[model samples]
Every structure is written in C-alpha cells, then in structure tokens.
Target chain A: DTAVSQTPKYLVTQMGNDKSIKCEQNLGHDTMYWYKQDSKKFLKIMFSYNNKELIINETVPNRFSPKSPDKAHLNLHINSLELGDSAVYFCASSQRSAAEAFFGQGTRLTVV
Target chain B: QQPVQSPQAVILREGEDAVINCSSSKALYSVHWYRQKHGEAPVFLMILLKGGEQKGHEKISASFNEKKQQSSLYLTASQLSYSGTYFCGTVRQAGTALIFGKGTTLSVSS
Candidate 1:
C-alpha cells in the first residue's frame, strides 16, 4: 500500500481557472506540508499544518489555499490560476516539527 | 535565503567516495537529508539535530555544523543503487518550516 497518496497525479487547467488537489497520508503523522517545485527543481514550501491547525504559511499568493480537515488529510486549492502556477505540487508529512518528512508522489499541475 | 548545494551533480564509480555539501546564509537549528530517485518520492535518509552528532546508514553518513549553518553528506563505497538526487532541508530554531536546497544529483557507475 502507498504510505502517502495524492489524487489527480496530473492536473491540467487554463489560466483564470480554479483547481484543487487532494492529499492523504496513512503514516499516522501529525504534521503535513505543501510544497511547490519550479522548473529549475527548486522546491519551495507553501504551507504547513499540524493536527488541522495552521502552523506555517510561506509567502505564497493569496490565490492558494490549504485546508486540513483532519490529521490524515491536507488539500490544496488554487483560485484563478496563472501560468506561473504550472509546477509540481508535493504533499509531505512528518511525525512532528523536527522529524524526517515523508513525501507523496507529487501532483504535476499544468496551467495554460 | 535558499540553501546552496555544491557540486550540482556527481558521477562516482562503484566503491568510490564522494561528499555533497549544503550551506545556508541564515542560522540553522537542524538539517535533514533525503534521496529522491527519478519518478519516485523522496526518501528520508537521516537528520542532524542542533548538536554535533554525525549520523549514518550503511556507508552513507552526514554531519551538521550549526555554527556555520552547513552540512555535508558522505557516500562511501558508493553502489549503483545509490544513484539519485540528494536534498538538504534546513530549519532555523525560530522557524518551523524547512527550507530546501535545489538538490545534488549523484550518478553511480559500475
């Protein structure tokens, strides 16, 4: 079984549209995070939540939103997507703030 | 600021040794190392806390220098299966989220 899984591994959309990617982890971790990987393979942290509470939110655009209904799920929603939003979005989790992180397969989002 | 990873890529023959370096401009409290193969999720290798402890798994080892906000990963007697991209994640004590480096690509040859 996959330790962490994300839906719609591939997300293709147009500019000015809205989209959402779902992520779930069964590793029983309390902390979850969202990251965006640019074309140059530079990974940037967008948000992090612990036990459904927002812990850290990077300097991301307001168009991006993260929701954690519970400890096992953390989903990302993007509104009015732009061409710059076309990148790989990764969902990750760890036992706590300083533990080793477990990453999901990643969602490749394409915006035209 | 983003952490800097040196030797963007490396090619090592089996049984060869290599070192990958990661440094940050800001102070750091901990550093994490992970390996990601192409088309695969990154797998955690080791973590170096604030202390000067060196952790290792098999022939792979890592050291963290809190003073200089730097860390080094040593791959000894590298094997073909060791081919992958290594990433270093750093977190300052005042911050909870980790800032990752671009990554180091390692190719182990026969």
Candidate 2:
C-alpha cells in the first residue's frame, strides 16, 4: 500500500485559475508537510500541520493555503495561481516534525 | 534557514567514491539524508542526531558534526543505481520540520 498518496498527480490550468491538491497518509503519522520543488530542484517547505493544527507556515504567498481536515489528511488550495507557481508539489508524513518523513509521488502543476 | 551544500554536482565512474557535504548556519539538532531520481519522490537514506553519530546504509555512510554544524555523506563503490540527486535536510530543534539544502547531483557512469 502507498503510505503517502496525493491526488491529481498532474495539473494544468490557466494562470488565474484556482486549483486544489489533496493529500492523504496511511502511515498513522502525527505530522504532515507540503513542499515545493522548483525548476532548479530545490525543495522548500511551504506548510506543516500537526494533529490538524497549523505548525509551520513558511514565507509563501497569501494565495497558498493549507487545510487539514483531520490527522490523516492535509490539502493545499491555491488561489489566483501565477506562472511562477509552476512546480512540483510533494506531500509528506512523519511520526514527528523532525523525524524521518515519507513522501508522496508529487503533483506537477503547470500554470499557463 | 536553508543549509548550504558543496560541489553542486559530481560525476563519478562505477566503483569510484564521492563525498557530499552539508553545512548549517545555526545549531542543528539532527540531519537527514535523502536520494531522488530524475522524476520520483525523495527516499530517506538516514538521519544523524546531535551527538555526532555516524550511520551507514549499504555502501553509503554519513557522519554528523554538531560542533561544526555540518554533515558529510560518503558514497563508496558507487554503482549505476547510485546516480541521483542527494539532498540533506536539517532540523534546528525539537518539534520543528526539516529544512532542505540546495542538493547535490551525483552521476555515476560506466
């Protein structure tokens, strides 16, 4: 079974369109995170949720919002997406915030 | 803060050795290593805690130096499967998420 799974492995939309990517983990972990990998392959953390509570919110733009309905799911909603938002988004889960994490396949978002 | 990685890229022949270094500006509580292929998710290699411990995985090993705030990943007898981008993630303190480095690209060719 896939430990961490995110829906919509590929997303292509207009520049101003809004989209959402859903993430779920069956690892029974307490912490989950969202990371963005740019063209340069630099992985940057965007948000962190622990036990359905917002923990780490990086310097991401306001258009990006993360919601955790329960401990097992964390979803990312992007509003007014721009061309610069084109990147690979990955969802991960860990027993603790600092422990080893398991990552999803990644969602490739291309904003035209 | 983001950790700095040295030798942005490395190319080695089969059975060769390579070293990838990661340094942090702040005090690091633990360091994590991961490897990612061309178009795949990053796989966890190992994690080193503050006590400056050394961990090994197959032909790959890593060392942590808390005082220097640095970690080194050593690849020995490199194989074709070892060709991938290696990333080092660091945690400054407890209850914090990992902050990854710029990453080091390693290419192993016959």
Compose the digit string of candidate 1's lDDT tens values, residues B1-110.
67899989999999999999999888887888989888777889999998778999999999988788789999999999999999998877633887789999999999
- What stretches of model 2 exceed 4 Å from their correct place? none
Cα shift from native, residue B56, model 2 (Å): 0.4
TM-score against native, each model: 0.94, 0.99
**Candidate 1: fnat, from 0 to 1?**
0.69
- The top-ranked prediction according to DockQ is 2
lDDT of each: 0.89, 0.96
lDDT by residue for model 1 (A1-112), tens:
8777898899999999999999999999988999998787778899988888898888899999998888899999999999999999999998886788889999999999
Cα distance off (Å), candidate 2, residue A97? 2.1
Q: What's the lDDT for residue A92 in model 2?
A: 98
By summed lDDT, which 10 consecutive residues of candidate 2 chain A come out lowest? A48-57
The candidates score, on chain A by TM-score, as follows 0.97, 0.98
lDDT of predicted model 2: 0.96
lDDT of 2 at B48: 95
